[model samples]
Target: MDTQKIPSPTLTLPKSLTGIQGLDEITGGGIPKGRPTLVCGSAGCGKTLFAMEFLVHGAMLYDEPGVFFAFEETEKDLAINVVSLGYDLDKLVAEKKIVLDHIHIERKEIEETGEYDLEGLFIRLNYAIDSIGAKRVVLDTIETLFSGLPNPLILRSELRRLFRWLKEKGVTAIVTGERGEGTLTRQGLEEYVSDCVIVLDHRVTEQSSTRRLRIVKYRGSTHGTNEYPFIIEENGFSVLPITSIGLDHTVLSERISSGIPRLDTMLDNKGYYRGSIVLVSGTAGVGKSSLAACFSDAACARGEQVLYFALEESPQQIMRNMRSIGIDLDQWEKRGLLMFHAKRPTFYGLESYLTAMHKAVNDFKPRVVVIDPLSSFIIGTNQFEAKSMIMRMVDFLKINPITVFMTHLTTGVNDFTGIDISSLIDTWLLLRDIEIGGERNRGMYILKSRGMAHSNQIREFRLTEHGVELLDVYVGPEGVLTGSSRITKEAQEKAGQLLRSQEIENKQLALERKRKAINAQIDFLKAEFDAEEVETLNDIELNKLRENLLLQDRIDMARNRKGDIITNKNSINKARGNIAKS
Candidate 1:
């Protein structure tokens, strides 16, 4: 029998999920397994919070215990500070799922105790890991030991050795450091932790503050390279991964009403698509808020939720204003279908504004979201940031498959602004104050609605007690007519037209009566002349007949007298013979 030697099975490292939603996504699965990661950031940049979330989410979500060794903050201070973030460290510690230890190295203690390597720190970390069976470890602000201990030569050597030991022990760990002027970490710890490095920055530009994070390098894995904006709020650290998604989201075929029937008709009698982004840009006093409220009214009417992000008005103010126009947002709020998140754009940078909106949208999960007058952000110090944030929000809402109606206030007299993102909008409603001769009227038109044949005619809209009312298109003395003036002007013109028509009718009737009278007189004269001529001709013919009869009688009498004389003379001689012959 021949004995064969089997090759030793190969073991590759497995990644340790950070449990940070955005961090895991950007890191492509989290940090490399059983390897140390470097997290360097400037002061007050939320490094400790990021690390703590990593541990807490791991322990809670994945059931992987973690150890948090604080080199800068004490265990008590860490526990107190994170309480506001809703993380109960003591509870986790009591359950034997987490371990919190504070390391304090005083400069005076270093002189009294003489030089020593960080060998004790290795032993302590291993003990804590074994006690809780933690799969993760965090050494927060580990660079502080170098400053406090003041034995740079020996401490640097041991710090390098400690990283190697942690790796060989097969426990995933995170080391945090303050960012140096030139190097990534203050003590260049990034050079030692060769697995992954993340950079956090808290920058203030033009009096607006923002927190950003970027992955400088990932030795064996791919990661998102762009700087991501994050927020540190009650829910702990949340990184907004500005990831670009392809047009792969599902497009709903359902239609939604904009609450104005006229506007709906303008949109092919179907309103807007179920997740389309509708932009309403207009001048001041142009009923932008009224339109947005109309949409909210429509949503609430359908028993769907609506989240209204009001940047210019408080909830009470918006409710009062909309109530005056017949939209009862208050009633919807009582019904628990409407939510309002009001904030001043000036109070924070554009990023903070986006964070608030993101959180509100997530919590409410409404079918509709309204950002009333996104122009408020544009008026602040950061114009570019405002536009970028708005675009990102539009993308997010579209992905949520919720209908969006964002109002933008134009500057000067224009009904549009340079900040108008036309391409990103599925429907753009351009509203304006049709000002002429001291009167201002509201008019709206669809600049563009993709995939829909919308009305091009500018329909005049009026803010009434019955909500938004869209009037028919009428080009009167004003460009578009509305209110009593339109009615009065139309009535006066109709009356003038009626008067002119009646005058023409009267003149035609009078001419017809006169023509009939003249024709009757001509007929009577012609009848009289014909009767007289017939009587005269009849009398002359009768007289001529009587004369001809008398002439015939005279001729007969002369012939008879001549014949009788001859017959009498002849009769004497031939009386005997004529008597026999007769």
Candidate 2:
């Protein structure tokens, strides 16, 4: 007998911060505890948002109160700005859970009378921490001190001292700075907050604006060093960290219909998969919204909650307009099945809209979400932000397993404007208005449906009072029709052909019936002639028989004239030959 010993497995753990929604999963957790993290970026790169979200989530979710020292905007302005984002900055202030100090470092407010240090900043910061008993602190745009103070050397030294002091105070701090060429911050603030450095960038590419965040350095813990897309929303900000986690790969098994039976049929069986993103892009006046509302209504009819985010129209206007097309969204709202949130995209920043959406999704817990038109969001943001927002929104929906339907505005009647969101969607439905023979007709087609077989045919659709109804596909000698003119021409040709065929069929049947009657009459006449043959020897009798036979032949001739006479002519010739032989 022998005994064996098994070796123990070794474990490696990552220490980090996870307070910001999906960020912790990316950073392995929150930033390394008690380290001064540097967040540097150009203006509007979301540096403040990144820092604020960390602190807000820390206080609200993890029970860690925080302090925010603003170097630019006042405390009141910051509170008001973040209020619409679903962040209760005022309440957090009232509860002493957060301390917001608007440090106005105006050049005129301070005098360069004598040699001094940033002892005033130290006192203010200490008072704030003592008042709130905070664990997290954020100095938004700490580089402002460099611009306000007179001595660069003293400012540099004081910055280094501030970092040391924060570490000694045992507060996990984030110091924001403006980005400079070839350096982390404009004044090289990264030299002091060197424990961890993050850079946020907002750039315009091909007219599209995008915001990206990257962790340039994380001192002790392992962290993702890639630039991630983040958004500022009504609830504050959300960073979409790219990771290998399965949280964004959830598969939804449920299916929802698109309201129109034909459209649903085009999608295979019924409709798209739950959690799938459906993009409906088309030129102007193609019934895109009508189609979207129809789908939303269908989901609501099935007892599923539906949230409609209408960016192009007001909620009341949308309800009124949809009524003309037979979509009673107000009724659905009354039944507690549908909710409509409509606002102008230019009314707020992209982050605010996203936060509103987040709130709507959270509060409504809808199974189906619809954005009447996503193109409007592009107005405030550049192409990059548009893409990032769309991607983040899609990811958010995927994780929740909610079906999302979005509409996009395109140019030209027949031409697609070509927005580059197709790659991120699960199904793309293109609606086009085709001009045919001075008339406009709408056509719909499923451009792509991932993981499912869909109809490749472009189907004809019409907006009616009952909603969008898909008609049979346009068929003609030249194949399927597109645009307005082609559809009209094909429809006309089809109607003409159908009419001609029907008329010919009717005439042929009438002639056939008449021909049979005439044949029967001739046979009876022949039988009479045969029966009376012996009695017809006299002139009078012969004359009567001849006249009667002539009359019978005339009736047969009349019947042949009504239709194709070839068959009747051959029969008549054979009969005459028989009579002559007899």
**Residue ranges of candidate 2 with Cα displaced over 4 Å:** 1-14, 22-30, 40-173, 176-188, 200-234, 241-249, 315-317, 412-417, 434-439, 474-476, 481-582
> Which stretches in model 1 have alpha-carbon errors above 4 Å?
1-15, 110-116, 244-252, 314-339, 348-366, 391-402, 412-424, 433-442, 450-457, 464-466, 471-582
The top-ranked prediction according to lDDT is 1
Instruction: Quantify all predictions' global Cα lDDT against the true fold.
Output: 0.83, 0.79
Among these predicted structures, which one has the highest TM-score? 1
State every prediction's TM-score relative to the real structure. Answer: 0.72, 0.63
Lowest-scoring 10 consecutive residues by lDDT in candidate 1? 573-582
lDDT of 1 by residue, 319-345 (tens): 999989988889999999999888887
Q: Candidate 2, after superposition: displacement of residue 402 in Å?
A: 2.6
